[model samples]
Target: MRIRAAEEPQPGVKWIDEGGARMKFLEVDDNTIDVNCDTWASCEDELHARHLFIRWAQFACCWSQGMMASKMIN
Candidate 1:
């Protein structure tokens, strides 16, 4: 899959697109990130967003292990 690089960091993203999908994230009290990536395009409003502790690993996306992004970032 091809990924468009961002000029700056962005939030919650996980994707592979043999078909299309979307994921969204929400933060809680500056402490956590809640994310959902539904393969089936379920109701956006009813995704029932929640929160959890955040991590750098969790936010990393658009590339798989050993790809250039991983190499450059590491």
Candidate 2:
């Protein structure tokens, strides 16, 4: 994922989920990005993968909503 400058991710901009865990958004009139994290698949041997995805999704949503990332940040 690209860590855009403060001026890039303007407020009120929404990220559109295209498919396969990928998202698309326009940073500006010309600059655009397709963020992909499509590795989230069924893990035949590891149930932990689902848990990991859930945890990560929660963290991301909270952060986007202006909640603290974590209380245990080191």
Candidate 3:
């Protein structure tokens, strides 16, 4: 899969498959990222590929919050 800036005059990331089909649209919101997949297979594949990174990001967010709380208590 290849990720690139959207070519459709939209504000989002586009994921294209090796065969040149668009697999997903990733949009950034204020608080969340939204993914619109072309198919269930694509959705599953993308999520599977990104699962670890997603978890790591969540962990980072939580860790930062914990640090902030600890600092406030000190």
On the 0 to 100 scale, the lDDT of residue 23 in model 1 is 67
RMSD, one per candidate, in order: 14.3, 16.8, 13.0
Best by lDDT: 3
Candidate 1 Cα misplacement greater than 4 A, ranges: 2-18, 41-74
Please write out the lDDT profile of model 2 over residues 1-74, one tens digit for every residue. 43445447676443323313544444454533334333345443345555657766875676545523443452
Model 2's lDDT to the true fold?
Answer: 0.48
Instruction: Judge candidate 2 at residue 3 and give its lDDT.
Output: 41
lDDT of each: 0.42, 0.48, 0.50
Give me the candidate number with maximum TM-score: 3
Candidate 2 steric clashes: 0
Tens-place lDDT digits, model 3, residues 1-74: 23354345654543433332233445577644444423222333666547644654676578568857986897
Report the C-alpha displacement of residue 34, candidate 1, in angstroms: 0.3
